[model samples]
Structures are given as structure tokens and as C-alpha cells.
Target: MLLGRHPCWRQNPAFPAIKASTFRLRRLPSSNPSLRFAAGDREPRSFAAEEMGKPKQYWLLKTEPGEWSWDDQVASDGGVAEWDGVKNKQAQKNLKSMRLRDLCLFYHSGAKARRVVGVVEVARQWYEEGDGGHGGGGDGAVDVRVVGEMRRHVELAELKGDGALKGFALLRQPRLSVVPVAADVWERICELGGGYEGDGGDADDGDGEG
Candidate 1:
């Protein structure tokens, strides 16, 4: 489903409001081994040339349902929200590697409902969050838009027992909030989530109250 730009975003009160000056937008260094970022020094470059028509990369994003649920994302202005406040170094790197149009599975990590509830498309790339100049560490953030809500929730227990998903980072590194999803794995999870059929279908905006 095509998502439009929306100006309203509801921030989690737990996270302090970040000032625009605190972060600077810069392109990822080309020397980095991963060819994740779009080439050239221009702002907001398209991936058509850099991707060479390869399947888009996929990711899994975890959030506590009570804190920031799928409904919250859909309700956000233009379905856009900043994926910020990540403190882990590895998770921060994953955020940096994200490119526009990358798909993300929105997983609810709440104790009561640990499941994949919706999908999101990366709308913006990486920007660094400063450490308040106190020497405290900061991390990267991205902007994502709600793509669709899963018809059926894919629970954690189901994935853990499925041999096909054994190697998924969500199962291996349960503590990590952000993780990469292989193309095959992404398809499989979508299948389990009630035949999502990729980007062609409309996203269900119903309350994903799992």
C-alpha cells in the first residue's frame, strides 16, 4: 500500500524530546563493507541503481504494545514515526544500514502478546542522536511508515518451534530490539500472518489487539 507523508507523530513519554540540533544527517561511508546505503553525496538518493533490481531487504522491529502499539503507528500523522532511542551498538548499526523502502515486521514484545502484529516501510534513512555532550553514548534513528497490519499475528512460540525460522535473529537474539530478516524468512512469516502477499495488498488498519 502506498503511504503518504503525515506531519503528526506521537512520541513516547519515556523518551525525552530530542532537539533537531542534537542530530546531524550524513550518508553512510562508502568504505564500509556493507553496500547498504545509496551511493553519491546527494541528499535522499534513490535505490533503483544501487539495488540493481534485487529483492528489498527486510527487518524486524520490536516494541512494547503498551508503549507503542501497531494502532499507535497507524494513527500517527501520515503513518510516520521516528524509530529512535536505541542504545545497543549492534542495533544502532542495523538502523544505520536501513535504506528507504526496506520492509520491517512490527513485533509486539509485550509479555502478554509476543507476536508480529504489523508491517512498516522505511521512509527515511539514518541520523545520529548526540550523547547530550556528556560523553554518554547515543545511537541512530530512522523514520518508518505503517505499511499494513498482519491479518494473523505470528507468535514467538510458533517461530521458535518452526525449523525454517530457527536461524531468525528474533529467536537467536531475543534481547535485540531490531533484527534483520532474510527474504525467505520474511515471506514465510508473512504467510503465517494470514497470507500477506507482499506490497500489493492493502494493510488492515483494525485494532491489532493481540
Candidate 2:
């Protein structure tokens, strides 16, 4: 089922709106041994993000596993695929705001599937996309590539129950297909998904399967 057909996403004002992300990264601790910025050493890869003067952003995009499962996403040509079928106004804005390299949580929604199963990177920004017959009629869409599966999946109940995530966008706007994810919330979820191992380096988003 395309996101447009997902029953839970039908437009309704019952849910509260989540604030848009308007912040950017200012500094990264140089004390971490993993990131050596000492005198003569070459800069680490993450330095570019800091140089750009824009804080990295995170998002959560919900999809039904039966319609677009993790396997399907990982196998998409070049490990990337078009993310369409969002009609919610706020969700459309979220898609448009995405920038290259932005990270997103791939969430599965439905009967027994409300969980964050993996991570993906924004490979392309939003563009004009026609309704591919799914009836989303959304403002636009973006392209995402599989980052990797989480070491552990995070369930909706867990997120809702965690007092730290009381301001989480997912819980606040349950009906939106695409929602912004606060960095802290992103880190917390990553921790719950089995440590903060998103780079796939010491963990899995790297060249190896998670």
C-alpha cells in the first residue's frame, strides 16, 4: 500500500503540529579520539558538515512494510528510491525542506509494525512529482538511499512511554507520514536501536550489512 492509501494518514486536524527545524550545528567536540583534529592530521569526514554552517537534520518517514519493506528499499536500484505519496501539507513541507545528506528514520506503520527499522540518507532534494496513480497529489517528493538496518528496532510504545520524547514529532502528529526528528530524539532512538551506530562504521551503515 502506498502511503496515500494508508488509513492512518488521512487528513485531519485532530493532531497537533510539530515545529519545523530551524537550527543548525555550531560545533563538534574535538576531544573524541575517534575524530582526530590534532595539528597535522587530515580533517575527519564530518568536518564538511560543520564547514557548511548548517546543522544536520533528521526526519522520520513512515511506510507500510507490505507496500515498501526494508528489503525492497535496500534492493532499490543503486540503493535509492523515490519517496512519494504524501498529501499532508505539513508533511509536504517536511519533504521540501530535506537537503542532501540529511538522515531519516525509516519507520514501518500498521498492525504490529509501528517501529523504526532502519536509517536512510537523503540522496536527492524534493522535486515536482506527479501522482503515480497512488493519489497522494503531494507538493513534491525526495529520493533516499539505505543507510542500514538498526541493530535493534524501536517500537512506538517505547517512544511514547519514554518521558524524554514527550515533545517528539511522531507522537505529536501521529497522522503525518513525514515528520522532523529532533537530534536528541534521533540520538535516543539510535541508542535504543542498539547504540549510536549509524555511520555503519563500528556499527553497520558502513559497507557491511547491519
Best by lDDT: 2
Off by over 4 Å in 2: 1-51, 133-139, 195-210
What is residue 82's positional error in candidate 1, in angstroms?
0.5
TM-score of 1: 0.67
Error of 2 at 202 (Å): 2.7
* Model 1 steric clash pairs: 6-78
Query: Against the hidden reference, what TM-scores do the models get?
Result: 0.67, 0.68
TM-score of 2: 0.68
Q: Candidate 1: misplaced stretches above 4 Å?
A: 1-47, 129-138, 201-210
Task: Itemize residue pairs with steric clashes in candidate 2.
Answer: 24-55, 25-55, 200-204, 200-205, 200-206
Q: What is the C-alpha RMSD of each candidate to the true structure, in Å?
A: 24.3, 25.3
